[model samples]
Target: MAESTTIEYLCKFCRAVVEVFGPQYLRSPNAEDTTRILAQNEAREFYGMLGSIDCLHWAWKNCPFAWQGMYKGAKGGCSVCSNVFAKLVEGHAPPVNFKVNGRQYNKGYYLADGIYPRWSTFVKTISNPVPGGKNSYFAKCQEACRKDVEQAFGVLKSLFAVVRQGPLAAVDHQVPVAWAAFLNMRQEIRDPQVHQELQKDLVEHLWRLKGNA
Candidate 1:
């Protein structure tokens, strides 16, 4: 009975997401908007980038002990790992016009961490960046940009108390519902003054680190 109920609820939630919010909140950007995205990326010194890519785990507090081994890891909880990437670049598509070091390319990229595979589409910070050089600068910038994903997660968890409860402990089943909520929430808090102030402080801190390096 519980299994059937879970399935039914998941279906209804997913359907509602697609019918109501998918078109507006869950789409890749059209080509016309690419220029704006490029400008934003250039400001962060990451030309041709769409956004940061990362994952977030939503813990299943009531997960069955039998299956816990599969879902549980060092994190000490049975959790569902959500691909927390697409939402960040919603309305942004790939095959973007990118230029770096005077060379032009035609693919957008995401700043990611080391666990992700090395691909042209994902830029990982230097594990051991050489100090006082291009690698150090790039590493700093890459990490700074990558925080967009983290901030998005933080925003969702902080703003939505219900959502903070591991997506109602059915995150694996209600991904669409969670994503819909996140999309709506993102628009509401696009860029508050406090975030801008914090960003400025971070930029200054990075510059100081660069100078010291």
Candidate 2:
């Protein structure tokens, strides 16, 4: 009965997520209209950046010991970690006509940590710094911005205790359902004016800091 109930609960929540956010949030954006203006503001030349990508571990208490080898990470716990992006778009696809440095590109990029592979679409943080200069400055800004992924996930785990505690058993579809819930909860501002104002403030602050450094 307990197993059955858990399965049913997962099914119900999963359905609720799809019904609530599918049409508007999960579907891919129209290729032509999705611009990279905000991302460009974050970094001078990094246009068309989708968001930050990273992995986080969630404790899995009910895992079988036999399976621990595969599920356990270096942290020495039975946990499930997901490689997820801070931003979500419909169809998990990026818009075409993506350009960077005056070169036309086919896909958008995600900022990630160094552990992730070096790919055209993944921007990894610099491991070593060379005193105070643009390279170090860029690394600082990149890391600060990439933290959005961790902070966003932190909010989700806070709101949904079930996620923080981990499900009794993992379901493949639960990840997307959780992402849907997170997107709704994050309450992103759609007003261009609000974003513009915030961006202006951020740019000024960062430039000021650079001058001081």
Candidate 3:
């Protein structure tokens, strides 16, 4: 016989669905546990820097023009997308609440392209650069931080192949936000460590590529 979807099963399914497609999805599946772990890890790796920020576009099956203004592509495409801004911090060691050591970040800042706002929390890349001066400490750090956001989006797209395909079936405009939340939850549960490692490795790899190019 086919299995029944009972309330207990439904609850679990809803939780999973929310965990996969709701706002605050990242905080759903044992968020306390994952956040603690991630905060600790980020502390060790980033010397207290939080996470990265970037924009992503998701197709809106029936989106209106007003919403489209916020969904511009990196190369000026008119696709419907959501601009996600995230912070990745180091994982603090055990028993300390795993809260980010924000003091270390007082002097440090996050890197972004021209899209993000100029907040005290984030640092934007140089809109224009002097010739032969692209290789500087500040430039390198900015490049490193910006790459984290790109890699985070990359991993998200890779795992949730549906996101890579096209517009979602849902009619609600908030569906993309829900999808982002779900992806965040999955990241929290399954491969937090993998992302941390990838972030670290990508910085070195990109630097090498820049040098070669």
Candidate 4:
């Protein structure tokens, strides 16, 4: 089957799977279940968080340059990127409002970089000169937290290899939507415990690299 056809087939399969197995198969037992598991595992294992939020860019095969402006990267490129906002909750599952209309919510009072707006729910790093002219701790913390979102994108791209390469056909926005749904569904099927562990490892690894640099 063509790539597009394959995606359509998988989407149908996912809908059928969810119907047969139930939505519980794609989520935690309940919000409380999320809170407890996240709190226990993330605090003990990861040290800093339960998750992070960031954005990912995918080429829009036939999107107009005008609309593409809305999809540009923070560095000023006309690329199609999806804003993904996430966070880790200790003894708690992550937020229930994960994605809204394919755009991740920019909530929480955590750290982020300049690219994101400084909402009451988020803590963005500010560049301020110190009396002694040393690097700002606030800046460092922001960079660290921001990395979580970046790493999340990396993992998603790696797992869903299709995303790493190519322009999604403009004919079907549903294709990408289904693809994201599949990714989320796959994460659920693999178990939250395992997903939490993977996140913990990735955060630690990224932190180490940031430290070295």
Instruction: Identify the leading candidate in terms of TM-score.
Output: 1
Global Cα RMSD, each model: 12.3, 11.6, 12.3, 13.2
- Work out the TM-score per prediction: 0.52, 0.51, 0.42, 0.44
- How would you encode candidate 2's per-residue C-alpha lDDT over 81-186 as one tens digit per residue? 5433333322233343443333454445566666554445456666686757555666677687778666877888888764577443322222344656566423
lDDT tens digits, residue span 1-213, model 1:
699999999889877865676555444455656677678877765666666554345667899989998887443777765544343334233346654544555556566677554445556666786797656776678787778757876787788654455332221222334657667545433434423332333344456556786
What digit string (tens of lDDT, one per residue) describes model 4 on residues 1-213?
699999999989766765665544433335566566445534433223334334445555566777866766665545653332221212222354332113333222333455655333333455663633223543555466568557866887787644565322222112333556556544443353533333333444445545677
Q: lDDT of all predictions, in order shown?
A: 0.57, 0.54, 0.45, 0.45
Clashing residue pairs, backbone N/CA/C < 3 A, model 1? 29-91, 29-92
- Winner on lDDT between 2 and 4 is 2
Alpha-carbon lDDT of model 1: 0.57
- How high is the lDDT of residue 109 in model 2? 54
Q: How would you encode candidate 3's per-residue C-alpha lDDT over 1-213 as one tens digit per residue?
A: 335657668668756775566544332113465455346535434332334544345545565677657765566545553322232221211122221222211222334566654444344555555544433433566666558667876787888755565423332223333556656543542343433343344344445555786
Top candidate by lDDT: 1
Arranged by TM-score, best first: 1, 2, 4, 3
Error of 3 at 206 (Å): 17
Model 4 scores a TM of 0.44
Model 4 RMSD vs true structure: 13.2
Off by more than 4 A, model 2: 1-17, 20-45, 55-92, 161-213
Clashing pairs in 2: 26-90, 27-90, 28-90
Worst 10 residues of 4 by lDDT: 84-93
